[model samples]
Target chain A: MTGSPRPARLMDGTALARRLTDETTAAATALHRRTGTTPCLATVLVGEDPASVTYVRMKRNRCAQAGIRSRHLALPAATSTARLVDAIGELSADPDVHGILLQHPVGPHLDERAAFEAIAPAKDVDGVTTHSFAAMGFGLPGFVSCTPGGIMRLLDEYRVELSGKHAVVVGRSAILGKPAGLLLLGRDATVTYCHSRTRDLPSLLREADVLVAAVGKPDFIRGEHLKPGAVVIDAGYNPGNTGDVHFASARERAGLITPVPGGVGPMTIAVLLAQTVRAATRQLGLD
Target chain B: MTGSPRPARLMDGTALARRLTDETTAAATALHRRTGTTPCLATVLVGEDPASVTYVRMKRNRCAQAGIRSRHLALPAATSTARLVDAIGELSADPDVHGILLQHPVGPHLDERAAFEAIAPAKDVDGVTTHSFAAMGFGLPGFVSCTPGGIMRLLDEYRVELSGKHAVVVGRSAILGKPAGLLLLGRDATVTYCHSRTRDLPSLLREADVLVAAVGKPDFIRGEHLKPGAVVIDAGYNPGNTGDVHFASARERAGLITPVPGGVGPMTIAVLLAQTVRAATRQLGLD
Candidate 1:
């Protein structure tokens, strides 16, 4: 291992998100001017998860900035699956709502999948539906989940070639890890997904030319596990704004590393807004 | 390694499939008696791929024996995407055709994804549609792809516990490799997908508790790569009925191994018939 300190090139999501939001705002304005109706996103949150509430608020604020209308539905934590499904169904049936974003980890007892499924595929701008996941996995055209979509966009923006690259995704959660791996595969990268119980995670991580750490463990991936000149994307959003990677050690070894605070975090809302405008455009047959 | 020769336990897919077909036959009979409509599967094929033809024939024979109706759609090799889409759309819209199976590798030029997408999710018996793929990946209730479904059935038939196992799937093809890994992930297995450009493929194979060799290369996986006592499933069927895993060497090292000709092949047809009945039952609301 080189003891030399290599300056890691940062992937600035905040700047890229600003650019994306500008494009989305223009698209939303165009749609509104042509159709006399603004693109609308319905944000549904169950219970009072501080994180969920904060995420929805951020999304709504971004929506307003992008010239998209925001419709908020805050349900009680103890809401039943049937009632939640009914509400989502109603929103799906509403013509004004072009997109729907159901905040993740709805509650302890609610069936999150059933609730997400209720959102019509056309209006599933958050890309949490099974339809979206399948489309992503199969390399079919569909809205991608915000975080993973953000990661891919960053890779594309940096001109990091994905074809035949060994991408080791250190997480396997449905929305994050699995979808991330599938998206990498869609770009022709040979993706290997590692999870909590995966034996020899370090060994697999070392083989990656592109390593995506989404396992939510702060500083779980150290410098030694990184392949020399590997592009590292830390998608973990832990408390205190910590990342999954040990950045100090990783930056010394990595060719590229995304910082915790300004990296992948900002891109989520940007993609959400971008997809909202897309959904509106497609619904109105503008595209 | 133990020098003693252990007699290979046969993975009797034919017998297991027969048993499953018998059970399905009874279910179909019951449904027919109650609803007066036999479950039907529409098999669509483009061009005359000899292997695919044989596969479809086998499925139809099995369906007939199980008292299920078969609807066949055969298009010429030069069939346009629009015509093929139209044919599939017709089948998808047919109320009598409860399930749809579009035999794969339609043509090099044809957009297979578009063709597969034409089948409605409700009648996607073979589970090739994006909706079924997402459903499987998310651990939701949906039809599974026949080959992967058959592989799971074979594992269950032999009492192979998947949870917490290190499963190395050596392929990433849309239907087989990709879905196989997702199915394993759904079962809580730590799944790693290796493909054509995957570096150190053999080394990854050496670490697997369960190894699924789905890459089409004949005898690609050698015995040296086999982890001792690994449950090996060779889903590859090459010319002359060869498998991707070198069975002679793998058999020496593996605790259990599925023979290429008999292991996963029969299970595919069995699963198709079973899922056809399932799709029929679900669509008819008879279950």
Candidate 2:
């Protein structure tokens, strides 16, 4: 297979996610016994987008398995921004709800940020609010964006050394790429952000010791562009069940890589559940 | 002179600052005439570190010159974080106070972030709060750190094209380097942050089309490290009237450069005055 040099080891995100789910289950049980209040996550969805609906359902089912309760709010797609804000505000004020997750892409007309900001900082389990973002940037105590947080966990589990390494993040979306890069920077890896406006992508990619493919385009990063033995993280998901990086050729050059299907997807929900328990424990004064 | 290339065009921050000050003065006068209330800035300083005191005085003097009122609060070095927080909270609540500037390097014992959070985001004209930082990162409406804001203004006056250009930030201190890099990123520049842990400094610097030298150490960057014809912004302030970049050598290679003393220094105060008037106008519903 094209002079494969041991075909770079795949990071096992699915296995790690299972381990995390078990741990979260125990923590949720302990929290429930101590406080007599099941950790509740308020999940809000403003539209009937199939992807968002399925994703929210997946999270709620996981919550049930972990002994966490779900308070689901399904608003009409035509809801006003003000009404959506009010709905989230009610969830924020409810003491029983330990965490909040507002499914994103709440329609183009709605003010997503205004709605996200309505989630109380303490209950922002999805880490979508400005408060959580600032806390992440400042290295303060707060919940992190689930996907980026999971990517970091995967790197840690694989024992990849981040310090002094050149990490090139190939996207700058608020939740995924920007936070991922900042989190890497916090670990002392020299960080660079290359976007659509980047002049020379191949040149920049070759300098990266760790490359995070976060641009939502299938096969955006190829083996030719990769630095030898680079640690590649594919954080992008497309409709055809592929990642931003071309898997087959990338494995030839990469020392460590994440597969499209099992790499970043499961870890995200696992992190969300774990953070939900932590949020509940903190709110219940048991942390 | 070893092949003296035409010296880099010096960015005249002093002249730009003067023009900005004239604009700020006129704005302040208009706000006062319409609302019958002068724009007021509250300057809070902890510990009488001679340099801190001098810097506060400089800002206060500039505020007065711009037709802005100053309320100075100099806390004793021994004051606890609680006391500092309480003092800042009072000013945040004061209706007459249009803006707040808390000098950085507030003693080692106190929680600086906690104290910063006490100031309401509305009056955070100095932009040290988490809200302001998030706003800056999200490319939303908010105040910005004075020095970084001034650096942006200087770049604008010179008609520097930032889109798709590589911007290298030499440091990552909370107030200066971090904000400056984020600001550049918002302007669509491909940004890189290189700090003490960076492995190859010269390699990264050579890629920069817009280089921001913000490391506090003098002579940290040299001419050989710069990309020939790069826009060099030396935002460092050293004790002996020098900046982080080696001026004589850098001028030979740089296409445009800011001098240590007259560049980046005056423009900071100008932005502060301008933001104060803006805060007042917005608060008074005149915006």
Candidate 3:
């Protein structure tokens, strides 16, 4: 198994996400045609961190392409927690807004959870709120955190059988790794969560049938940790557009693997737009 | 390994919980003496299911023994979700109530999550709401679900090293298996959740270093599934007071085990009382 020179099947998340976005665009157009209500997504950012700004701009562009209107509310870097919550509350109550997205890393001073709690669960398409987390945990119908949500969609698109498979998630951030593990558990996969504190990462990672590398360190998961023929979803995008997994070595060992830039990234924005349209349809009682 | 006849060490939950209750009593008494305010637990039971009635009664008794006050609200089984939510809202606002425990299974017709959401997160000692779940997941400072909280305390008391250990939880109920897995994950343990839908239960169970048997079925976990020297925490109490694990067989091969009647049951009530006093101290601005 170690000397085999077979290349892994690349899981084409970009292509699948393109199809999904097309479906979302048709649904958004149809909803507007029938109800005369355009689905709207409100994007809130506390500071103009360049990366966060780029990410928010990309999400807005995706919404526009999907026929969903975007509202941008850029606040000052020194915005108080209460004021941020108030802004989110206003957008939550706005009848025109179908979904809410609060860009992450809100200056490190703002209370992200408090601001997220202010968004009504119905409009939490970014799925940062506790309500959405619980709904995801309990396998209830609610929006999901986009990266984790998109990874699951990619797995489904490739016909991965999750049941009874040992899925080792290599990070435990509230939105990404934690929720991803819960979603896999909902699909009957036996899920294990590892993080910086976990002892002997290689020992556990070697047992995973499905490995999700979401740790934000470049090439953190080497080829030796991967089980042969594992389905690897690399959700990490560090500086220089590098991924957490060592793709050159892993692509040979893995049965199916997602590339760094063209993999989980494209699927994430696609899920956000798709969920926004669903939120609008559900809120408008058109579902 | 299979032929070894070593008897498992019994985790004495009854004694550990007694010590914990004593500590809670001291705190409750001290808080009352300093602030002239008694810690109060508001227990709302929507229906008179005999088991729920007995469970609530046991919890109230434990609270009284720990110098905490218990306020019971018995509602008709047919109570509307709105009315139940209103009831919980009143208790949440009541200054005298430091902790709230809405008895589970508040009738299938009622929106249980809605009613639980009505209880303020500060007062949710039972830890049923999504806020508490997220807190548990994120390892934020918040009250935990009592039974899972108790199980963690037991593991700590026995000097269990959770980091990197495979902790397999055998149920997925919102409060028990799910939160238990989250708590283990927070401790850096590799957690796997298996339910009725899991295709290969014994295979996964065989790898667990810490096995939490929460499946409601009696003797669901046999001796063959347990790893040698594994710490077994059986949270299940089926009819006839039998636990999910076949204790007679499991005790021979396991390193530590909890009995059916005396184990998880005692620690749960102890945690509720402890949290109520903590809530009272915090609410009274005496923390």
Candidate 4:
């Protein structure tokens, strides 16, 4: 109430997501009619991490709504790296499975990279593999990480002029922060990556035309750190269902902003379902 | 006489390269004594382009100097993509060959990415494959693109603190400019990539704390565009042996600069040789 008179335009992820899913549903139905093949996604989740379980359940629900098939593999917490690789390898070899999604933070004991490599590049719809990452980094055609891909789709929906703009990404995780920066770089944005090791985060944040807060800390990016009229993308999903940005304060100064529950969250599953359809089409030689 | 009274100190590529090669030579010797297998590098050139021939020859010469064996395969310019891929596939399967280097810009017709993919990931010493690129992008354990690898080495050797520093890269070639920016981002630099479509290049150049001029156009980056006391890296090797930077004027303002002939040129081959030794040791179980 104490800030700018004109509040920022909210980037409505829910409405945009509904439109995206309508298109995806039509595509899936058409593909099923022509090829007599339902787009199938194989999801592998290690351990019953409550958060991961809920995430996977949400994805499964989204897939069902989109007319895509979901096959879930629930592995125990004590599974070895070799066993996880074998499980993923089996899915990668299955012609019926068009896409593979492996839940992350799968126990500290497993070698994540090795397990990711086991999934065929073609079946990497979740975009967690290094092959997918390399393709994304090089701006080549490949699956992209779901959350980052969602962020890009949202930006595109808003008709954001990314070129020549300074995009400050406040994280460096391989999946979210890194790929997001690379994707922005591919689109001609001057991308700056700041991590825990980065000095003077607020000073750098103030220079951004587009600020992406991927650091998974609630209310980490304050309104004062942002440049006035900056486009704010909150990718962080921390405890208490809050995002990385302090929404109330940030909304006053931002030109555009995404709400926590209704923003980046919905678009992620939308991308996953869409990519799965693409994977099925390509694999079935129908595209 | 027309420049600043104190020119920027040259980051001596020749001397640093010598130290690197000396270390590689010792490692090669130790590996040979342990496994009785000398490191072997396979150089493939697909055309009679004078530049390609010279580059392959230079790489082979350096391999010999380090006591590493060299194998050369010269193919006709008219060779089909399939034939080129087959040739590379054979080398990738050859147990005696520790590393592979393919001379780029084979022709306008052939698919470069396909040929690069033919090289086994483990033996991609030149780091041209998508696998290598992904590894470099993800900050994983794998070989980097030679020139970019060398640039990182030079930066590390000079103890250039990249964290939170603005690094402006003036190109976006798949192998050179793109990888260079990713490497700087990996080291926590705020990276900006400028290309032909980039608007207001001069304005962006002024903000750079570390500027990499990989644009092939000589004198493209004028002295007035550079920031005072900036670290300037000239990676261009254009016609007339001139760099992308206008050395005469830019050196006056820069605190550290790499000259055209003796700068980034020598470090490329040095990294290639070093990676070949690593490949040999890893493949031979001598690590």
Best model per lDDT: 2
User: What docking tier does model 4 reach?
Assistant: medium
Rank order (by TM-score, best first): 2, 4, 1, 3
DockQ of 4: 0.55
* Model 1 C-alpha lDDT per residue in residues B5-66, reported as the tens digit of each score: 57346677878888988999999998999899899999998999999999788889889999
Clashing pairs in 3: none
Q: Scoring only the second chain, what is candidate 4's TM-score? A: 0.97
Location of the lowest summed lDDT over 10 successive residues in candidate 4 chain A: A1-10
Candidate with maximal TM-score = 2
Docking class for candidate 1: medium
Per residue, candidate 2 scores C-alpha lDDT tens digits across A123-233 of: 999988889888888899999999999999999999999999999999988888888888898999999999999999899998999999999999999988888889999
| Positional deviation of residue A46's Cα in model 4 after best superposition, in angstroms | 1.4
Q: List TM-score per model, in order.
A: 0.92, 0.98, 0.91, 0.94
- List the candidate 4 regions with Cα displacement exceeding 4 Å: A1-5, B1-6
Ranking of all predicted structures according to DockQ, beginning with the best and ending with the worst: 2, 1, 3, 4
Residues A130-242, candidate 3: write the lDDT tens digits. Answer: 88899899888899999999999999999999987889998989889999999999998878787887767798788889999999999998777788888999999999989
What does the lDDT read for residue A217 in candidate 1?
84
In order of lDDT, best first, we have 2, 3, 4, 1
Q: Across all candidates, what is each one's fraction of true contacts kept?
A: 0.58, 0.84, 0.62, 0.58
lDDT of every predicted structure (CA atoms): 0.88, 0.92, 0.91, 0.89
Global fold similarity of model 2 (TM-score): 0.98
Candidate 4 lDDT by residue in tens digits, B110-186: 98888999999999999999898888887889999999998888888888899878898988888898889888888
What's model 4's lDDT at A90? 95
